[model samples]
Target: MATRWGLCGAGKISHDFSVAMKTLPPGDHQIVAVAARSLERAREFAKKHSIPKAYGSYEELASDPEIDMVYLGVLHTEHWRLGLLVLQAGKNMLCEKPFAMNSREVGDLIAASKKSNVFLMEAIWSRCFPLHREVRRLLAEDAIGDIKLVKASFGSPQLHIPRSVEKELGGGALLDIGVYTLQFVLMVFNGERPESIHATGVLLNSGVDESMVVVMKFARNRLAFCFFSIAVSLPNDATISGTKGTIRVLGPMHCPTTLEVNGKTTQYPLPEPSLPLNFTNSTGLRYEAEEVRQCLLKGLKESPRMPLSESALLTEVMDECRKQVGVVFNQDSQ
Candidate 1:
């Protein structure tokens, strides 16, 4: 049976997601509807994607019986509220990254998912890439022995983007792009919580972080360093060094299609999408969509690869990082 999807936002990310869904077999995935803040916008997105239904309100989408899952791709600040609505409405959800503004929101959504007995996943699309999977396999095989240090950075000059700079909108380099680097570090360390965290950053005039450098010390003297920025351009690559060898994830770390193991480069190309994507390599989203379908078919409430626990941990790490760097969101006090 095809897992029907109802998209909860009509933005560029949602558009990319819808386009990526088209890359999969129609028999396995179907976008049944889309909802946006404005009815006209929803209708336009629906028309663009050829979806069967369009809703002006997210509540309408959540209550939809035809939708097996809801993809919440709204702004960072809205995830908690919208996520709870979907889970409470008895719908599975694949929420976009920085799952919520803080760990408190993540906890509430998680509890709601358990209470509703529905599948819920944080849409950290990078973890689903073929390149990431291969990296995991190599790590498991001890290709990079001991795993001494992991370094990653993701930076883009997004000073002109309102959503990337506004504090009220939950804008900041840490929450926006740092999540990818943090998740990458955690993934390399097998989701183990770090023993200590140190973060320093440059905050915009709005009091949100413009650039951040974080160092985490994990078990057995293992260390991970991450640099994220919206004010500057960075190498945007990741390197993992071990006692024996090294593995490097090439630039555009969020959705990379290439990796270098001990200086030997290999590429994992993405599937072609019918529509042009707003983001790079978004067709790789098919992997996560397929994972959701398979998990739903098997009656699972969460994905093993991107578990709810990991989401919580990732959010907690971000929370600590923000606290250390003095980036405060409105939701933090609530």
Candidate 2:
């Protein structure tokens, strides 16, 4: 049975997701409709994807009875608002990541999901990757021993993008790319919240964080260090060091297909992609989508691999980090 999708937003991210969907075997998934603020944009996206329906407003998409699930590809700030709308419409959702602007918003969404009796999951697709799953298995087997220090960096020269530095858009290194490093660290620690978070960031003139470095203290003498930026270039690698040895995910580790453990390397090659696009490892998106499909088939509300609780915890950690670093989005005041 194909899981029909109502795609919200017709932006680059949505396009990437649609492209990824094309790589899946037929009958696994179907995008039934697409909605954008502008009718023309919605029609264009629907045409490009060969979807049957186009809606000018999100409300129309919400009311779509044919859609079994919605893929919310809107901006970071809109996740909470649109998430509530989707849940209220009795729709399951796979919302794009940095789930909400803060922990409170994430909590509200969780409540809505529970009340609506609909499944909800954050689209932190990296957690569903084969390499990440393998890493978890190795860690569980004590391959790295007691993890002492985890370090990661994700940075890019993306200042030209308005959303990358605009405060109203929930722009910042923390919510944008820092979430990757944060989740990566949490994955190593088995989703344990840090005991203390200390961070410093370089804010743009627009009052959004352009770059940040965070050091988090954890129990059992464990620590995590993360660096992210929207205005600079970084190696974008990740390392987890422990008493026995170290595991290093190679550059572009955020959506890595390869990682090194104890100086030995392994690669998890993605399926041959049908599309040649360079967006966020769309090749791996199918893994998460399949996860959602399997869970829905089993009547599950959240994925065990990337549970809603972990999503909220990650948001809470980011909230504390932003408070300490002084990266304030407009919604934070609301």
Candidate 3:
């Protein structure tokens, strides 16, 4: 069945999602409609992407019964509203990361989804990559024994837009790049919410976090140190160190372009990806799309692979961390 898709924003990341749908397995997915704040922008995106419909308002696209799913690539603060719109429209929703500004909004969205009987998920994307899946399998197989410490970080210096620091839009490293870093911790530790957390960061001029470091502790004495920043980009990576061996993710850890294992000071490559993986252009979007397809086909509302509980927990972690770090978004304090 070809899943007709409605894209709910014409942003850069949304454009990437559109591109990824183009590469999906034939008859699996297609972009049927595109919507933006304005009809002109929506028409332009529709024309560029060869979409059949363009709407000025998100409601129009969401209410379109032909759209099987809606992918939201809007502002961070807008995710919750747009997700609710799509869900209430009787369509599955794949929202951009951060899911919502806080756990409260996420909880609200989750409840609405359940009430509406619609599928809803955050668009983390990184959790579905083949290399990362192999990494998860390796840890399960005891390739790395008794995980001890893990570190992950991602950032880009180019996103200097004023909105990046604007607390109103929920713009910050934790919501942006930090989502991927936390994925590393969640993946290795089986999505266990941290028992304890302490985080600190420097806020930008508009009071959003520019850089942040969070420390988390989980089951069986496992620990993770996650870092993120927009002030300056540094390495943008993740490392898993276990008792027996270590695994170093070779790409921003978001869409690892490579992975390496360490053996007594010797380093070697893990198996290269089998199918063509999207890193730069798509950033693992295709894999997530596949995950969603499988989940929908199986009649599942929440993904066991990326459950809503973890999604809420991650935001809670960030909320607590942001509080401790004194990184306050304008809307958060309201």
Candidate 3, position 95, lDDT: 82
Q: Which ten residues in a row have the lowest lDDT in candidate 3?
A: 264-273
What are the runs in model 3 whose C-alpha is more than 4 Å off? 263-283
Could you tell me the lDDT of residue 6 within candidate 3?
Answer: 88
User: Which segments of candidate 1 are over 4 A away from where they belong?
Assistant: none
Worst 10 residues of 2 by lDDT: 271-280
TM-score of the candidate numbered 1?
A: 0.99
lDDT of 3 at 314: 81
CA shift of 318, model 2, Å: 0.9
lDDT of 3 by residue, 1-334 (tens): 9877889999888777777766666589888899999999999989987899999999999899898788888998888788888887788888888898888888888888898888888887877777777787888898988899999988777456755767786777888788889877987888777788888788777777889888998878888998888878777778999998898886557866577777432222323333343346373577788888888898889777778988888888878988987876655655
For residues 77-160, could you state the per-residue lDDT of candidate 2 as single tens digits? Answer: 899998899999999999999899998889999999999999999999988888888889889999989999999999999999
Candidate achieving the largest TM-score = 1
Clashing residue pairs in all predictions, respectively, total 0, 0, 0
Q: Compared with the true structure, what per-residue lDDT tens digits does model 1 show for residues 37-107?
A: 99999999999999999999999999989999999999999999999999999999999988999999999
Q: CA shift at 182, candidate 3, in angstroms?
A: 1.3
Evaluated at residue 19, the lDDT of candidate 2 is 82
